[model samples]
Target: MTPDEFTATYREHYPRLVNLARRIVGDQATAEDVAQDAFVALLKATLHDEQTVPRFLSVAVKNRSRDVLRHRKVAHKYAPFETFGPLSAEYALSVALFIDIIAALRTLPASQRRAIVLRTYAGLSEAEIADRMGWARGTVKSHTARARASLRRELAEVA
Candidate 1:
């Protein structure tokens, strides 16, 4: 594709691709980075068909998200002990609570987790989440509602 075509494609698809990556990776900043990287990779390649651009970008974003998740897993394995250094009692308690919430999020089923993350962290509306996840709008709402209830119960028990 030419530079203009590439620019147009990027503008059209960037937001949706970033949302897709965010669903996979669950972090907005990292998702943006992943989407940008995919576009950069597309620019570097020679492609004869503009029609394939969206599919190519979607696959690229998924691969990059997987790479990021793998790297995070490896990093967590060797994370430094001082990462959570001495803190005030209130600060420590808050940190513990945050950790607990993350753990609770992980325990949810994959659909529930993705729905909750997309809705809460990415701030996507139900219709947007439905489009990204290829689910009906009502399905997204149901998943999010169930996930929220489960989290509430789990956190309440912990408290």
Candidate 2:
């Protein structure tokens, strides 16, 4: 597609895309990143089937968000070695909280985590999520349900 077309598409879909990214990544800032990344990808995107532009964008945005979440999961998995050489007290406290939250999130299976993130963080409808994640709608629903149950079990002791 042309640059103008890409821009038009991005403007049209930006809000929903942000919502989708937010659900997948679990934060406003990260969601913005995902959405922005989608737009960037769209700018340079060249699909063999130009008719499916929207679908391509939807999948790209979701995949970007998933990548962000996967990165977080990986980071969380090895957080014990994270360091701030000149750490202030507040920084140390923040790092500790980050580690704890990551540890808790790690309790869930990958599918459940992605499902929860896509539903809650990205604010995507189940149908949209199913399309983006390339999963059956019912499977997405089941994963979210399981994620919620797992989250409850993990967070129950936190508070």
Candidate 3:
């Protein structure tokens, strides 16, 4: 894509892509960085189809988000050394739970994922999520409820 096309695509998909990354990595700043890096990578890539740009960006964001999560897991696994102590069982359990939550979040549909992530992770109210996602308040509620139910099912074994 040309620079102009890339700019337009970035403007259109950036928020959703960032949201996607946030769902996986669970950090707003890191999500934004992942999205930005995906755009940068897109700019460097050669694609014959403009329609595939969004897909490309989404895949790139997901892969990069997983990388962030992996690196975080590794850092947390070894964090006790920096603190001059051994890793606590509680800390290890929390890390595993976090990883499970992210995996469960990924299994949700897009609307449900957006709703729950905004509500739980980003700490947005239902109205705010509706406004950001361009859905009705009721729709947001429904999505959030269903998403929560699905997450509960997916993570029940963990608990």
Ranking by lDDT: 1, 3, 2
Worst 10 residues of 3 by lDDT: 78-87
| Candidate 2 ranges with C-alpha deviation above 4 Å | 81-159
| Model 1 misplaced stretches (Cα beyond 4 Å) | 84-159
Q: Model 3, which residues run further than 4 Å from truth?
A: 81-159
lDDT for each residue of candidate 3 in 36-139, tens digit (9 for 90 to 100): 99999898898988889889999999999999999988888888665656778999899899999999999999889989999998999999988988889999
Q: List the residue pairs that clash in candidate 1.
A: none
lDDT of 1: 0.94
Q: Summarize candidate 1's per-residue lDDT along 1-159 as a digit string, tens digits.
A: 777877899899999999999999999999999999999999887778878889999999999999999999988888896654577889889999999999999889999999999999999999999999999999998999999999999999889
Which of the two candidates, 1 or 3, achieves a greater TM-score against the reference? Answer: 1
Residue lDDT tens for model 2, 1-159: 776877788788888988988888789998888888887887776678867877877898889987887898888877775442467889888877677667777988888888888898789999988999899999999999888887877767775
lDDT measured at residue 127 in model 2 versus the true structure, 0 to 100 = 94
Candidate lDDT values, in order:
0.94, 0.82, 0.92
